[model samples]
Target: MRKTTFLLPIIVIVVAGLMSALFIVDEREKALVLQFGRVVAVKEDPGLAFKIPLIQEVVRYDDRILSRDVEPLEVTPLDDRRLVVDAFARFRIADVTQFRQAVGVGGVATAENRLDSILRAETREVLGSVTSKDILSSDRAALMLRIRNSAIFEARGLGLEIIDVRLKATDLPKQNLEATFERMRAEREREATDERARGHEAAQRVRALADRTVVELVSEAQREAEIIRGEADALRNNIFAEAFGKDPEFFEFYRSLTSYQRALKGSNSSMVMNPDSEFFNYLRSPSGGRAVTPPAPLPQAQVDAAEGAALEAAEADAAAGTAASEAQEEAETDVNNYEVDQVEDAEDGVQN
Candidate 1:
């Protein structure tokens, strides 16, 4: 029993010692062995690892990509513009041994601080060479590339591999931004006013041209209407002349009858004529102006009827002659008035 007790304790102590000496590392981690607070060795793989119990220790480091967000920086451009630049970087440990020696294990905070300083220095150097417009637009990509290359070169000695350098945002100070906005608004308003003035001038030109075209069109239409009316009148006169030329005597007799009807139909007028007047001769003598033999006395009823018919015929002839004379006089008067008007118009045109 004494021998069994002694072996059980020895086994327990052995198990405890083994447990203390053995270490575990995950696949994503790298561990460094330290003895008496000094780094002795590093393990860069997964699975079980060994160490001196209670004397040697393991310090783990992340063997993966890491990120750091830099603080905002003030930068001035070539155009004397100032802006706030916010940036970030992605990085990883490229040489674990060098990293431990330079920054110590689990020294990401220190490395980030150093990187931020380098980033700020490089950002100033690059951005200072550019104008504000370039920094805001075309040169931004080139600037970022230059910064990344410079940061990578600088981080080489620190055992850090810079994966990317990016400018997240660039902004003007609030007060300066408000001033720029006001200037832009004023410029836009000026352009709008100029455009409106141009539009008004163009509209005036179009309206004037339209007015001139309207006047020209109206004048042309009036001239064409006058020409058409004159042609129609000429055609009507030619047709009348042809019809009248075919039967002159009948035309004259018809005209006389028309005159008599117009003059006497609605008139109450007294008339006097010489015995030898053609109007009376037509009623007294049937042989056109020659005298006829006197006849035996006729019945009173028959004589009265004959005399009444002759008087009516004479009165009608006299009425026709008077109306013809009046119509001729009116025509002459109209011709004289028209001539006077034309002469006055011609004189006025000459004076003007």
Candidate 2:
């Protein structure tokens, strides 16, 4: 009974010590064996891991991809524009031995903090060389790749592999948003003003060119009109000279008729002139010369009926014969009385 009791206690102690020295390494993690605060071995494969009992220790770190969100930081670009950048990273422990040696007993926590500093530095260095537009553009993927590659080299010293780095957001700082908008507005306004001025200048040039062309066209037209009018007047005068040279007498007759027409235009036309005036030469003769002749009077009235010329002549002769007989009888009686008185006067003279 006493021997079984002693072996049971000893076996329990041995099992407990073995259990304390053994640790499980999942496929998702890696292990490091440390002794006296120094890394002596690494277990990268998943399995039961062992260490010196009561003297060595095991440190485990995730072997799978891990993620970390970086605190937002400000970067000044080549354009002198400042941006606030939020970034993150995916990483894994590449070498557990090197990781354990670098981070010591602090394990994954310590490694993460150091890795963050490396990524931040690389982010600032890479982004500082580019403009803010590039960081905020579709080509941002390329920029992130550059950051990752640089971070990878830096993190390698700490036994960390940087799988990828990404920028979550890139924006201007809050205090600068309104100022940036105002600047953009000013730039656009200036460009618009320049365009308007150029357009106005072009319009003015076109208008002046058109006005000059119009003036030239009008002047040319007026010159042509004046030349044509002078030619027509010369043709008209030539025609008049030819007609006058053809028949001067006929021309004079036509001119006289025209003058008569003008002088006697209306029934109320009146003029004071001598009867033998040369203006009345045409009235004196149809041939229109100085010859003159009296015109016989024209009978104005005619009997409608019963006007026999022989009967009217006989009645007029009968009335004249009656008046002549009466006068002859009176003369005969006076002559007889006068002869009687003369005889009586002769007798009286003889008596005296």
Candidate 3:
């Protein structure tokens, strides 16, 4: 029982020692074996690893890519504008030995703190040389690249390979937003005012051109109309002269008759003129004036026939005149009898 107890305790102690000596390094981890607080071995590959129990220790670091989210940092750009910047960095340990030497027992946390400082310092240095507008411009990729390069250079001593550094966001402080918005609003208003002025000027120019076009068209139309009227008057005068040349007496007589017809057309037509006015010369004598030439004499047979016709017409006219006289006398007699009847009725009424 004593031997069994001693063997049992020895086996337990040996098993515990073995457990303490054996270590594991995963594919995602890098391990450092330290003895007396001094690094003795680095295990980068995955699988089982051995360490001196009680004399050595294993410190594992993630070998995979890691990210560091920096706190919001306030920076002032060359434009003297204050902005809050949020950034992140992607990095990995490039030299495990150098990493251990640089960041002793603090491990990943120490490395991260150092990386954060480097990122902040580099970011401020790069950003401080440029205006905020450039940071916000399409050149943002170049700016980020510059910041990354600068951070990488500074972090070289920290045994870190800075894969990339990025600005998550850049924002102006609340105190400056109102001023920025007011300035933007004023600039837009000025542009709008210029546009409106240009529009008004263009409108005025169009109106002037339209007015000029209208005046030109009206003047041209009036000139054409006057030319047409002059031609028409000339034609009328030529036609009148030709007619007069053919037969002066007949033309004058016809013209006088046309005038008389026009003057006497309306029932209320009246004119104040001398009895012997030239307008009535044709009426006074059908041949017109002193220059009137009588018509050619007719043949004897025609004259005889005309005289017989005239005699029959005169007899017909005498008979018609006599009938008209008798009708008038009868109308007068009827009117006298009606008046007498009216007078008799009045006398009888008075007597009654």
Worst 10 residues of 3 by lDDT: 343-352
Best by TM-score: 3
What digit string (tens of lDDT, one per residue) describes model 3 on residues 319-352?
5555555555555555555545555554444344
Residue-level lDDT tens digits of model 1 in 37-154: 7888888889999999989998888889999888999899998999888999899888777777878754878888898999999988999998879888845788898889988888
Give the alpha-carbon lDDT of every model: 0.73, 0.74, 0.77
- Model 3 CA deviation exceeding 4 Å by range: 34-46, 54-56, 81-84, 94-106, 137-159, 168-207, 245-352
Winner by lDDT between candidate 3 and candidate 2: 3
Q: Which stretches of candidate 2 lie over 4 Å from their true place?
A: 185-352
RMSD of 1: 19.0
- Model 3 accuracy (lDDT, Cα): 0.77
The estimated TM-scores of all candidates read 0.60, 0.53, 0.61
Candidate 2 lDDT trough over 10 residues, lowest sum: 297-306
Give the distance in Å from residue 12's predicted Cα in candidate 3 to where it truly belongs. Answer: 2.1
| Residue-by-residue lDDT tens digits, candidate 2, 34-58 | 7887878888788888898978988
The C-alpha local distance difference test score for the whole of candidate 2 amounts to: 0.74
Candidate 1: how many backbone clashes?
Answer: 0
